[model samples]
Target: MNTHRTAHRLVSRAATAAALATALGLGAVHTATASAPSAAPLSVRPAAPGPDGGWHQNGLHLTAAENKKVNGFVARARRAERAISPGVRAAARISHAELVGFDQRLKSPDSLKRKVATWMLESPGQTVDASLRKINDAVRFTLQWPAGTYSQGVRTAAGLLSAWGNDSTRWANTWNRPTGYKAINSAWRAPRSGQLFEVQFHTPESKAAQLETHKLYEEQRLPGTPPERVRELQEQQDAIFAAVPVPPGAERLTAPARRLPSPDPARRLPAPAPAPVG
Candidate 1:
């Protein structure tokens, strides 16, 4: 039975891979973490199509079951290209949904919140730096089975690009890279409901950052740390615990997040990437 299940899983993964290859063409596939120091969690959710004709959602709570759902969602998104041809913007919607579902599933919100805050506060680079750190942290945690929302965010981001062709430039901005590629990150937008936040990093570096971050988490958790070292780790954990963002609907969680500046018209551009005439 186990063998059969394993085979099934392999086949599913292969199918997904084949679909991605067909969609992305010869784009480089880099599965390493970015070089940024801090990152912000992209928060979004699902709702009626926004001004740009993309689905939107909020970023929060996730579960393992939802992760699978996200995977399924990506596969369907790829298939959608043939019919809806939703373009990168539509793909953006699918990506955010998968991630929001994942983040809400996390068991370590406090830890993720702390790491995100620290990265956002102390990181010396641009906004992308903060985003990269958060993405890495999220990816690392997700690998642990019942991982956190941040982890799911990483997965969702990669899946979006893989399933939907995007402009490279916008994707690069999400990772704080160069500004040449016409990527799908431009199609992202945030809505007031649902899960997952829309942001950038549709490039190869974003994927790299996720893989590398997972390695860091494994190394830090390696066995046989000195007592004092363990204490330090514990302290970091405690700090994170203190900084968790209370879920929006949680009765006990109440605090105001700084308001984001109004988005520019350029960021809200509505040119959907129409499919090639087949």
Candidate 2:
């Protein structure tokens, strides 16, 4: 695999995911119930004019109705998550049976919005619609294990997810050796809803590095960041990742497709429903 290309792709995908979340206005509020009041329409006040006398924001601008639709979609997604959590948790436990530390969480609306905004600013011409169609990280988990067990732990987790509901065609296991950010990311397409949710597996050290680099990544996304500063931030991240020891067999981890048992579909979590657009 082309490590550089893979790294760039991973970064792009991560940005797109955030942008989709923001477009859906998922970060604007907490999950709502079916009977909750409809979201208030976004203000039509124009964005502050840029130096070029045009709005700096350059992406698919969502309409009030679309935002409302996104709100509805988020609400439905939350409900679906509740239904699927059990199976996912069970699979995670089995995947890291030997590990005593891990963390799991659904992506918050606020974080998603920030990522979306950053991507929109950086890639002005891209539409987030397609990305929004399949929002993965809406649900994710992180596994924390000793450095020596990282490879074994991640491989086991990936295998379990593959057997559960991971769509082989959409599976991605990207490792950022420079930043020590390794993840077994995949799309789990629930048979019923046909919605794809994301699962991520990470080692503890890698997780810590990811958190530390997040702020730097955000700063690099700012409109007027100096190129030198960007490079500096990257170097810092590289230094951190360079210190993380690669466990045995980690370099060869792959997510080969697996066929799940046909008789017990309910053993997996329900799939997400496509987000509705008004």
lDDT of 2 by residue, 1-278 (tens): 69645533433333343334434443211111111112212221123333543322333234444334444455555556554444444444443432221222445543443444455546766444543564666544444556676665565555444544555446565563445345556667654455567755556666666778888876776666789998898787778767666666666677644653544333333322233334
Lowest lDDT 10-residue stretch of candidate 1: 137-146
Candidate 1 lDDT (Cα, whole model)? Answer: 0.31
Q: Pairs clashing in candidate 2?
A: 18-116, 19-116, 27-109, 195-272
Poorest stretch of ten by lDDT in candidate 2:
28-37
Predicted structure 2, TM vs. truth:
0.62
TM-score of every prediction relative to native: 0.21, 0.62
Model 2 misplaced stretches (Cα beyond 4 Å): 1-66, 97-104, 169-180, 260-278
Number of the top candidate by lDDT? 2
lDDT of 2: 0.49
lDDT of 1 by residue, 1-278 (tens): 99545533433343354345445542222212221112212331222233554222222222333333333433332233232222323332333322122222222333343343334344444242334323321221111111123223334434333323232222222111122121123222212111122333322333333344443443344344556776665555434333332222222111111223324332233323334443
